[model samples]
Target: MGTPAISGDPKPQITFQTKGITKVYDTGDVQVHALRGVDLALYEGEFAVLLGPSGSGKSTLLNILGGLDQPTDGQVWFRNQELTAASERELTRYRRDNVGFVFQFYNLVPSLTARENVELVTEIARSPMDAREALDIVGLKERVDHFPAQLSGGEQQRVAIARAIAKRPDVLLCDEPTGALDSQTGVIVLEAIERVNAELGTTTAVITHNASIADMAHRVVSFADGAIARVVVNDARKPARDITW
Candidate 1:
């Protein structure tokens, strides 16, 4: 099925046509190879999971795809544009206009209410939903007026999620978004993300340390030693709360 973003206009077909994509970092004389010829294709509206250990380079690959980092070799094409060689200014514009990010911590503004914190991004986006609407999407309507300090960790993370989706980002990049919460709370956060991915049909990519989270993805990619060790295709995905070790 087509994504929610495939509305009036045609949604640009999303795919990776990498012949060989590699990332390398030079620390003085030492060299670290983060990615070794990653050739992968993630279609539009796909909910994909990436799992790996700390140094396995899953996050590195995600960063490159999001334009936060560039690969050392090969090309990354997001539709028609080549991201790997994009100028810094272009990368900034691409990030601001097309991508939404969710980190492990909820970096909400302490002084602003949940609505206002979300409003901060809505105000600057080219075209964005109202802050109230975004909050409602995450099932946080009642908590909209609460300040960050007044809410629980799960609530705060939901607010952050609301802010990210308000802009209608084409791609949602989440990095260990539930790592700080207990399993119960984390499931709530994951449910919020799942709802967004399913409802909004954002091309969602989540990087997680928890192996169980893979059960919810359409495709689960496991990284080992900077390479894809195994890819599991799930015919049926359980919700976050229903998944177990």
Candidate 2:
């Protein structure tokens, strides 16, 4: 047998592979070091949670990963493309084609119905999934026709998630996606995000102050003093809606 025939499965795509990433902010002669060289690798379709205390650089890291901010130093690569050195137009296209963002506040257009708000992004995207189908994945298909004002906070957040995924982006960046709601409502929002991640296989990173959310992630990174203090990989991940911690 001449070197038993190897069936090669092409290497799995890497969503983000960052090395020695740093972010610094300057305010009136004061230098704020947000991140001091963070090294991370997020494989395609991984669900990662960034956990930390207030003043930690989780948000800053997430922003840099999502193309909302550039690093002060170091290299940032997404799908083998160097995001850190990419031009503004290239970054914009990268964000539009490859990343989606969700924040603490449900940023739905109040004037638009749930479906319409999601449709807006799809209309501007290169290739998009159907808006109604994306909403359905978040358990909001029944509420698609309802305006933002007509929906509850949980419902609105679900719509916001649908909007984010409608573009069929490879990476989903969530900064405190459930921060603004009560625990009960927040759980619902998290469940919606979980459903999307499971169904769409979108690489996700959630920046959260709630350490409880860490159990739901495949990997949890703890940030302190603008640096990662710990990284834990949970072999058994708790579902968002089922987690009490």
Candidate 3:
């Protein structure tokens, strides 16, 4: 399938853009292509869901957009900055100042309370929200003092969401935020992510294999064989609470 054209009046601001980007992993005697000439644009304050099976390049694209990995060829732009040309120091700074990341696992410190775990990011952030405020946004105000071990799986994921957004990043990238949870718990976690995008106007991109989650996004990009196979613009988006599996 061809790349779908995006249509909008007074075109929305593009938060991230990639042109013909490709990624290749070189093993001892073989080369594995993770992305094959991908071209995509994510708009400001828009919630986008990337849907694909394993090794379809969704996570690889997310990592490159988050500055955790570099594409082997082509170019990437974050607003007006060309990330493909940035040095390692610049990339690190970009990731620190502009991006927020959430993964499947809750990487909270075992010994730190929820608030303390969030405080670690706020302490070094350029301008951060109070740890308590971050927790409140994720519906964990009452559990701020609890450690990760004390919270339920969904609650722990919410705390992870809080930590990622405590810095008030311009973009939020999540790789399978609910992959480890049951349907009910996953819905709660999705609600927290939906809230962040709605409340903070953060440009959010979520990578998921669950097709139902696509119903909650402004745009759904489907990947196949390391390339985008289709893009559907959702005019009637459902709330994350309505999603299942």
Candidate 4:
């Protein structure tokens, strides 16, 4: 069976392509290979999970795909644009305009209210959703005026999700988004991410070591020793609320 469609568009086009991608970090005395001869593709409006052990290169691949880092060798294409060939300024513009990122940490300004924190991105975005609308989508409408300190871990992560989606990015890249939370709170954060990907049709890639989380992905890419070890296409997907680690 084919992977079940989370978005109505089942046969969406490719959003990103990597050909023989490799990333090596030279530490003067030694070199660390983060990715080696990796080839991958992510489809538009798809939710893909990167699954692996710690230091298996999942986060490194995600970082490269999101334009945070470039491959030392080979090519990366974000749609028709060759990201590997883009200048630093162009990469910055691409990130600002087309990509949204969420990390394990909420990264909210402690001094700002939830709405104000989201407004920081919407104000700079060329065409953005209203901060309130974004918050509402993430189920944070009631917490708009609350500061980060006033919210729970899950709620703060939801606010971060809201801030990320307020710009209506083409791709949402999340790195261990629930790593800091307990199981129950992590489920809530995953629910918010699920809502964003399903409702907004953002091409989302999430890196997590939790193998159980793979059930929610349309496709799961497993990493091992700086290479993609396996790629699984799920015949059916469970909603985040239905998933349990």
Best candidate, lDDT = 3
Clashing pairs in 3: none
Candidate 3 per-residue C-alpha lDDT over 1-245 given as tens digits, one digit per residue, 9 for 90 to 100: 22222334346788899999999999979999999999999988889999999999999999999999999999999999999999999999999899999999999998999999999999989999999999999999999999999999999999999999999999999999999999999999999999999889899999999999999988899999999999998878899888976
RMSD for each of the candidates: 3.6, 5.1, 2.2, 1.7
**Model 2 worst lDDT window (10 residues):** 1-10
The reply for model 3, stretches above 4 Å from the true place, is 1-9
lDDT of 4 by residue, 72-179 (tens): 999999999999999999999999999999999999999999999999999989899999999999889899999999999999999999999999999999999989
Q: Each candidate: what lDDT?
A: 0.85, 0.84, 0.93, 0.91
Each candidate structure's count of clashing pairs:
0, 0, 0, 0
- Evaluated at residue 94, the lDDT of candidate 2 is 91
Model 1 lDDT-worst window of ten: 1-10
Q: 176-202 in candidate 1: lDDT tens per residue?
A: 898898888889889999999889889
- Candidate 4 stretches with Cα past 4 Å from truth are 1-10
Error of 1 at 236 (Å): 0.9
Question: Candidate 1 local accuracy as lDDT?
Answer: 0.85
